[model samples]
Target: METKLKVGDKVTCDKFASLTHNFVGSIEKIYENSAVVEILEHHKDDTVVVSDFHNRAVVALNHMKKISA
Candidate 1:
């Protein structure tokens, strides 16, 4: 089911440790087992903005799921 989620796909993750993600973003890039989500925009998970990130946060593919249009 997770495999259906691909690069550029939008997702609504209900369980991402601390945030019930309603945020929408594209899968900027992917790897053999992970991806780099260039978080386009977030609603409330601004715990740390990308601008604040010293380095890009490449999240595990499992941490995100593709959402419908």
Candidate 2:
């Protein structure tokens, strides 16, 4: 079993951008290509994360790519 999560895998989600793009909530549901991520907090710009592209909408799997520090 891998430490990271895969598609269709039930797990909790936490965003490091909780302070900025906090609109994303817990793991509500999973879709075919997109995960139905709920909105727990408030977010003005979801695209705050450069890795998330220019849209702060969907949290794609590739978005989980670790940013080199």
Candidate 3:
């Protein structure tokens, strides 16, 4: 099933790649299978990767869950 996510929506992304923990952010842009998330909250251990990506991450739609409120 496809998740109805949109820009400006708050979301959390499951860990992937070198990321050691999940993270929270807002949707900045959307793609066919992923969205660009602007990092708002994240694990301290992921600081390096989060910063490296300029506080943004391209997270797959399936890996993201929208925050209700």
Each prediction's TM-score versus the true structure: 0.58, 0.33, 0.90
In model 1, what is the error at residue 59, expressed in angstroms?
0.9
lDDT of 3: 0.90
lDDT of 2 by residue, 1-69 (tens): 224444334333345443353343444344555554444444456434533533233465434332111
Q: Model 2 scores what on Cα lDDT? A: 0.41
Screening candidate 3 with a backbone cut-off below 3 angstroms (N, C-alpha, C), the clashing residue pairs are: none
Q: Using lDDT as the measure, which candidate wins?
A: 3
lDDT of each: 0.57, 0.41, 0.90
Candidates 2 and 3 compared: the better one by lDDT is 3
Candidate scoring better on lDDT of 1 and 3: 3
Order the numbered candidates by lDDT, best leading.
3, 1, 2
**Model 1 lDDT per residue over 1-69, tens place:** 336667667654333433444455677677877776666656555546545642234667666667653
Tell me the deviation in Å of residue 34 in model 1: 0.9
> What is the descending TM-score order?
3, 1, 2
How many clashing residue pairs are found in candidate 3?
Answer: 0
Instruction: Point out the worst 10-residue segment of candidate 3 by lDDT.
Output: 1-10
Q: Decide which is better by TM-score, 1 or 2.
A: 1
Q: Write the per-residue lDDT of candidate 3 for residues 6-54, one digit (tens) a residue.
A: 8999998999988899999999999998999998999999999888989
